[model samples]
Every structure is written in C-alpha cells, then in structure tokens.
Target: MNETISNSPHQWNTQELPVVVIAGYGPSIGESTARQFGSKGYAIACLGRTQNKLLDSVQELKASKITAAAFVTDCGDTRSVKEAIQQVQSHLGRISVIVWNAASYVGSDLVTGNDDPSEILNQIVGVGCAGLLASIQEAYEDLKAMKGTILITGGGLSGYDQNVNQIAVNNSWMGLAFCKSSQRKLAGLLHARLKPDGVMVGTVIISGAVRVGGGLDVTDPDDVATAFWEIHHSRHKQEVHLGSLTQLASEPT
Candidate 1:
C-alpha cells in the first residue's frame, strides 16, 4: 500500500506522498475526484493541456489544503504524456492512481460528412485511449509497487440501445460515443492484463447526462468520484454504470 500521512498536513513531504494523476483535470469529475483522493492524503497531479485551467484547479485544491500541482501536456501525444508523468514523479512522488478522463470529438457539421473521413476517425480516437496507454506504460513501476488503480470515464453513448445511438446521433456526439466505447474496451483489456500484477483497473460508464451542479443531472461528479474511491479499495468490479443502467437491471455482472 502507498504511504499515508499520519501527521499534520503542514508537516507533509511532497516527495513521500502517493500521487493521483488526473489525465483530463477539469471542473467536473476531475475536480471532485481530486478532492476525494486528496482528502485521503494523496497528492493530486492535475494533468491537462490548458495551463490556465490546470492552474485554477491547482489553486482551488491548494486552498482546500490539498497538496496539488499542475502539469500541462497534450494527452493524445505519447511524448507529452510521458513527459508529464516524469514531471509528476519529480515534483510529487510515485503515482498510486490514475483517472483517465480525457476525450475529443468532431463538430456536428463534420460528422455530417462535410469533412475528411480520416478526421472524423481521428477525432474519435482522441486523447482517451492513447493517453491511457501512455500513462500505464510510464507509471507501471510505481503502480505495481503500490498496487495502484486506474479508473476510466465512459459515457452512455457506449451503452443501452438505439435510444442511446439516437441520442448520440441527434447531438452529433458520434465521435464521443465511439471514443467512450473504445475506452470501455480498453478498460476491460487493462483490467484483465493488470489484474495479475496487482493493479486494479475499472471504468465508470455514465449512461446519461453528467452535470456537476446537480439539478436535472442524471449523473453527479461526486458520485463518480465516490465510485472511483470504492473501486480502489475493493479492487473488484471492472465496470460500473450509472444513470440509464439503473433501468436496465440486466447489466452484465
């Protein structure tokens, strides 16, 4: 198990802290997840392409008395992702967990076939799958040593029925839908591959709208964060579905 701080936060050592690297650090799920883990004594490593956004999240985390820092990098690029991992280790410590939540997509007009076919496919591949692969390779040593976990964010576009497909097409979310499906499969593959090595891997497939502020939101960011934490501790349940899955009842166990 990764070392946890038993003393005051003021006496914490950054290098001795176990890091939780958020691949697509943002205001929603990422922020919630960071807080959830940080409160548990893990140093948060905010990884994203936008420096301003990363800094904002870092400031908020710091304000909450959580040890956090940002690393700006394009998740789709292997070199950039690997470099960020190196930087996180240098600044924080060994990475004990990774929340892979980066995504990309083409515009509605592009999906309507007005642009290059390859572009649509490229957009679908996005930062989700590739970034995850890079992180696993780069952090394998620390993850195995600490029995770390990887939690992926998936969407409803990859589940349910034609209702889901219709919703995806209506909103021009084809690329995102494809990416989520791919991410789910990637999570499954990693779950089986990493299990023997003591590294748990799982995916939270959100089967509806995710609104951080609640209201009419079908999925809550805090819930996702809680699920991640549960998965980390239990080291079981490779896939967890939210929202729409509640009605399905027959979701694979």
Candidate 2:
C-alpha cells in the first residue's frame, strides 16, 4: 500500500486509511455511501463531472470529520475515468471499495426511436458499460491488493419491465432500462471472473423510489447505503435487491 498522503487531512499518515472512490458522486446514493463508509474510517474520493457538486459532498464529509477529496471527471469518458482512479490512488492510498453509481438518465423524455440511433446508443453505453469497464481495468490492481469491493447502483428496471402505457414510456427511459439490464449482466460477469481472485463484485438493485432526509424510512438514502455496506462485507451475496424485490415477487406475472 502507498503510505503517502499528499495533503494529510487527519494529521497522521492518512495513506494508511482505507479509501473508497465513488464514481458517480451525487446527492442520493453517492452521498449516502460516502457517509456510510466515512463513518467507518474510510477516506473518500468523490468523482463527478460537476466540481460544485463534488465540492459540496466533500465539504459535508469533512464536516462530519471524514477525510475526503473531490475529483472532477466525466464517468462516460474512459480516459477520464482511468485518470480519476489513478489520481485517487496517488492521493488517498489504496482503494478498498469503488461504487459506480453514476447513471445518465434522469427520468427525461425517451426517444425510443432516433434518426441517429448509433449516437444515442453510444451515449447510453458509454455511461453504463464502457465507463465501468474503464474503471474496473484501471482499479483492478489496487483492488486486488486490498481485496476490495466493487458496488454498482442499479434500478428495478433490471428485474422486471413495468406495464405502463406507450405514451408514458419515454425513449430515454427505455434506453436507461436497457442500460440497467446491461449493468446487472456486467456485474454478474465481473463477480464470476473476479470472485476467484478475491475481488468481490456486487450490485445493489433498488426496487422503489429513493428519498432524502433521515429517520427509519426504508427508502431513505442512508438506509439504502447500509445495504451497500452489507453487500461489501458479506462478500457471499453477489446481488441485493432493495425496496422493490418483494413487490415484484408478490405481483402476478
């Protein structure tokens, strides 16, 4: 492990601290995951496209007395993703967990059909599959050294297709659904390939809506984050469906 902290946030050799790199740092899952890991003494490397958002998350983490730094990068770009991982490793020591929670679609209008089909497909795949591949490739060595965990955020779309009307189905959403399914498959493949090497890969497939705020709410981001932490520690279960799985199970097919 690289026992060299550039800034040295905690006074001690901060490099000795376990690090977690959140690829898609955001208000929901990303923030919650950071806090969850930070509470457990993990240094956080938050990667996102928006510097302000990244800074906000880092500030909150620091306010909570957690060592954190923000890295600005586009997860959709493989080169950027690789560079971000290298930078994180250089600054924070070896990474113990990396959460790929950066998703592209935000419930916008879907263009199920487009004149430039290839362009749209590339955009979706870049965020979903390509970015993940780049991150995994770059972080594989570091993860292997620490026996790390790779946690992915997934939606209920991967589990089952909803029966909503055609007008309600946005093309972008359909694309996202496809991307979610692809991510799940990729996660399974990664788990199969890396499990033997002691690198745990898992996906937390959320079933319902995620909300902000605190308390004992099951759908709260903080609570959802616990599932992610559990998934990493468990190491045995490759996939965990939170919120929606039971509803899906009870529904008539």
Any idea how many clashes model 2 has? 7
> Which pairs of residues have clashing backbones in candidate 2?
110-170, 110-171, 110-172, 111-171, 111-172, 112-171, 207-244
Name the 10 consecutive residues with the lowest summed lDDT in model 2: 163-172
Off by over 4 Å in 2: 1-15, 106-115, 160-172, 213-218, 245-253
State residue 62's C-alpha deviation in candidate 2, in Å: 0.8
Writing each residue's lDDT as its tens digit, candidate 2 over 101-151 gives: 987673344453444766766777788889999988998988899999999
The residue pairs in collision within model 1 are none
Q: Please list the C-alpha lDDT of all candidates, in the order they appear.
A: 0.79, 0.77
Candidate 2 global lDDT: 0.77
Off by over 4 Å in 1: 1-15, 107-111, 245-253
On residues 97-151, what C-alpha lDDT tens digit does candidate 1 reach at each position? Answer: 9999898776454435567877666656758787789989999999999999999
**What's each prediction's TM-score?**
0.87, 0.85
Q: How far off is residue 75 in model 1, in Å?
A: 1.2
Clashes of 1: 0
